[model samples]
Target: MNHDGLRFGNLDYMQIAWSEVTPGEVHASWSGHLTACGESVIKAKPVYDSRVRDITCAECGATAVFDLGTAREKAKAITEKYEATGSLSRADAVSLRETALQTIAPQAFKARRAGDSWNAISSNYLMSTGAATETDGTSILVGRVGLAVIEGLEVSEYQGGY
Candidate 1:
């Protein structure tokens, strides 16, 4: 464990890595960085560090992730595509995570209302609900973002209104 009490190989830690294999992505990123490799998810594995300051991959000499369209737009298009063709983009599953939470459980939706003690509540909820990340909030790694669009909210906005 380093100064922050984090160690390599911590699933709860998003490991900073050089993109030796691909572009616009990182290795073992699950340390809860919302914008990781444009994937929006980090798989829990061995790596180093946990502080947010080191979250940027530019430090590793890799191209940073491009924050494309908003989640709502992507969800809409994703659902339409699935409806017409029945195909899914597993690579884009991270986009559906928050929207799905808003669709399914509006009460705990962090985008709208995150009360005090959110970490405790979110951690407990994530573990029990089989959420993808160990971090707080409803950052679920949908793994198949299209499924949530087709099945869950039908690509509707979760927070305020569509």
Candidate 2:
């Protein structure tokens, strides 16, 4: 009856506190009957494991996976381009970022309704452009942006409020 839900990108997974003792027998808090093995499984402890990463959606039967490394790489590339050009305005940067996101996740960026636009659900952050001193007193300029990829898309502008 009571469970937790997790979202990654456009995918969602439910943490149902239940256990299966047989092929057709499942013990959970929602069901009053126990498993065929007579195991009284109630709200069990939720296990967070990478092996069970993907979950099928009950409504549409779609699977979604979250890859942070890929997102970071994309963000880094955008920031590096801005740093190289040195003439990118705020509007241009936002447009570039949104375009990149749309290219990355086309299915997730698909419009759900008529006259809908795909926009970022996450916060837009500015990239850092400064030199860093290493331990050996060497200066290095890295184009880094502590920005996460947009997880969800909506029919609205992501960077409208200035």
Candidate 3:
């Protein structure tokens, strides 16, 4: 049962199926809980070259489409921002994260300082440090700030387990 390079192993977290009767048309189905806060039962038929399609979540009444290129671009931009700033305000962090959620599913970003609380979340994945090496190539005090992307998003929720 070849499925046009689609495999359940790629989406072990959800129940998924597909029928490839025609050469370029594939009908796919998926049902499972998302990593964020919703249940999903999605059906979609996309031609081989299709770039966008919608999926409605049964648990949260949320309807969204998956755009892989856009999501990757957004993620890259967000990552570059963090790499440049090395730190972010709470509002900026949250806003960037929300923007990521618009194109992707169940994404989390986190930033923290050495002595600060870790209660905020973002949508981009990045990490940085303030530590700088001495001119003599000696180790110095470590940096206090850090950033990271926590991966729990259910790509299968939108990809029909692709």
CA lDDT scores, all candidates in order? 0.35, 0.31, 0.29
TM-score of each: 0.22, 0.26, 0.24
Distance from true location, Cα of 21 in model 2, Å: 39
Top lDDT hit: 1
In model 1, which regions exceed 4 Å deviation?
A: 1-95, 103-105, 109-115, 132-140, 143-162
lDDT of candidate 3 over 41-103, digit per residue (tens): 243333233221221221111122233333334444554565467565556555554544442
Residue 62 of model 1 has an lDDT of: 16
Sorting all predicted structures by lDDT, with the top scorer first, yields: 1, 2, 3
The candidate with the higher lDDT, 2 or 3, is 2
- Location of the lowest summed lDDT over 10 successive residues in candidate 3: 137-146
**Residue 124 lDDT in candidate 3:** 25
> What number of backbone clashes does candidate 2 have, counting pairs of residues 3 or more apart or in separate chains?
0
Select the stronger candidate by TM-score from 2 and 3. Answer: 2
Q: How high is the lDDT of residue 159 in model 2?
A: 28
Ranked by TM-score from best down, the candidates are 2, 3, 1
Clashes of each: 4, 0, 3
Could you say which candidate leads in TM-score? 2
